[model samples]
Target: MPTDLVTTAGQAAGRVADALAGLDLAGPVRDLAAALPGGRTATLAARPGWAELAALGGRARRHSDALDAAARAYLDAEAAARAAAGPA
Candidate 1:
């Protein structure tokens, strides 16, 4: 039963990651990936669970954050490119 709950949480995390992917931002998403573990840790602190939940959540959040960061980086780079092209 706990595994099932963890699986559901994992799926939810994946969905969030997918949504973040839709955004267009700038740079590598690595920074976000690096910070994701701690972010997820904080979230789970509010509600404890078995190691499976923690592991699943951490992985999911990292993937999600990376996706979001990529989108943000893409958008920022595009904006900067446009601004640089305009007259000074």
Candidate 2:
């Protein structure tokens, strides 16, 4: 439970969360669907695929959030322990 490791984990999780939040999981497929002549058919065909992708993205974001929370909790606990031990 080294503070440096905890901090690094938090930072890594934050980066992952940012990336996941910014992801455009369905944008490419949606664009392709719109560009096709039978746009409606393409859209229908891709509907399930995009939906699944979105769901996976949501799950990944949630996991990232959990990781961040865990890292924060560890840091907080370490701080509390140091404070309780007082004066080195």
The number of clashing residue pairs in each candidate reads: 9, 0
Instruction: Output the lDDT of residue 28, model 1.
Output: 23
**What lDDT would candidate 1 get against the real structure?**
0.54
Candidate 2: misplaced stretches above 4 Å? Answer: 2-50
lDDT of 1 by residue, 1-88 (tens): 2434444555667786565544432222333434555676445443423234335545667865565555566667767888999966
Predicted structure 2, TM vs. truth: 0.54
Pairs in steric clash, model 2: none
**Which parts of model 1 are misplaced by more than 4 Å?**
1-50
Against the reference, the lDDT scores of all candidates come to 0.54, 0.67
| Candidate 1 local lDDT, residue 75 | 63
